[model samples]
Target: MKKIEVFRKDKWNMIHVEIQGKQLVVREISDQWGEDTHIFLSRPALMDWVQERFSAQRFEGSEEERLSIIEKFKEV
Candidate 1:
């Protein structure tokens, strides 16, 4: 797994995106504050993230969590 290249600096980490790479699995590097991390290991991994973390179930969580995931999904 190679390092992930930034497709969109602000929105890249929020959604699963792969560009300039044939491989689906990607290694990630993050900053100290955990703002720069995105490890896309495979198509399944990305899909799993979407289904679990960014799914409609988010609406069942707190208002803050629901709004946050929705806003992030809007960027992609």
Candidate 2:
């Protein structure tokens, strides 16, 4: 993908965002910490809460295990 040129990261790695016109695109980027990061949430607080909970799990055994965990949160 061509770089979006629509977003930026601050000195503290806090992201600042913008999009051309009204278009929105979801993106994932890797930080210096070597983990994937996500963007473009309509409900950021809820999304962050979900991330916090999911990150606590030690049950990531396989694809089925991961899917089962997600299925438990489908309504959230």
Candidate 3:
């Protein structure tokens, strides 16, 4: 399982999330605010979840590529 750390929010309803040490900006479409925590997702997952909550995918990518993309976007 991948570890995800949710960061501060930004304008346009975007939330910064760190997955596997890489940061990704995802928008807050709709959510179920219940009990204690919340759940967020990107475009694809949101679509899938809307259709079926159990819908999920096994992503496949190289670590180098992921890290390279993250490094390219690093502010400093």
Candidate 4:
């Protein structure tokens, strides 16, 4: 598995984005509960999710790097 990105929602919560084989995996971790929630998506579904989630926002990276990350998701 390869970690693609991590979004820190707050001091106690985080969302981890990763790739396992051909699937995109999203893991939500909460410090308070000591539990995690995971979601898996195939390429098409992952692309749709990415589009809907990130279309109007800029990721926390350089433009070139952000585009590279998106391309990596597509390639996988």
In lDDT terms, which candidate is top? Answer: 4
For residues 1-76, write the lDDT of model 3, one tens digit per residue: 2433222233332223334233233323223432232243454543343334222233134555444434432421
Question: Which runs of model 3 end up more than 4 angstroms from their true locations?
Answer: 1-59
Model 2 lDDT, residue 48, Cα: 54
Q: Give the poorly placed runs of model 2, Cα more than 4 Å off.
A: 1-59
Q: Which stretches of candidate 1 lie over 4 Å from their true place?
A: 1-16, 20-36, 59-76
lDDT tens readout by residue for model 1, 2-76: 333322235323323443354443223333344443455455565565556546655345666655654543343
- Candidate 3, backbone clash total: 0
RMSD, one per candidate, in order:
7.0, 11.6, 12.3, 5.3
Q: Hey, what RMSD does candidate 3 come out at?
A: 12.3
Cα deviation at 29, candidate 2, in Å, is 29
Candidate 2, poorest ten consecutive residues by summed lDDT: 12-21
Residue 62 displacement in candidate 2 (angstroms) = 1.0
Q: Rank by TM-score, descending?
A: 4, 1, 2, 3
Clash pairs (backbone) in predicted model 4? none
Residue lDDT tens for model 2, 1-76:
2233322354433222233244223332336654334443354553454466446465335656455444433333
What TM-score should be assigned to candidate 3? 0.22
Candidate 2 displacement at residue 46 in angstroms: 4.2
Worst 10 residues of 4 by lDDT: 52-61
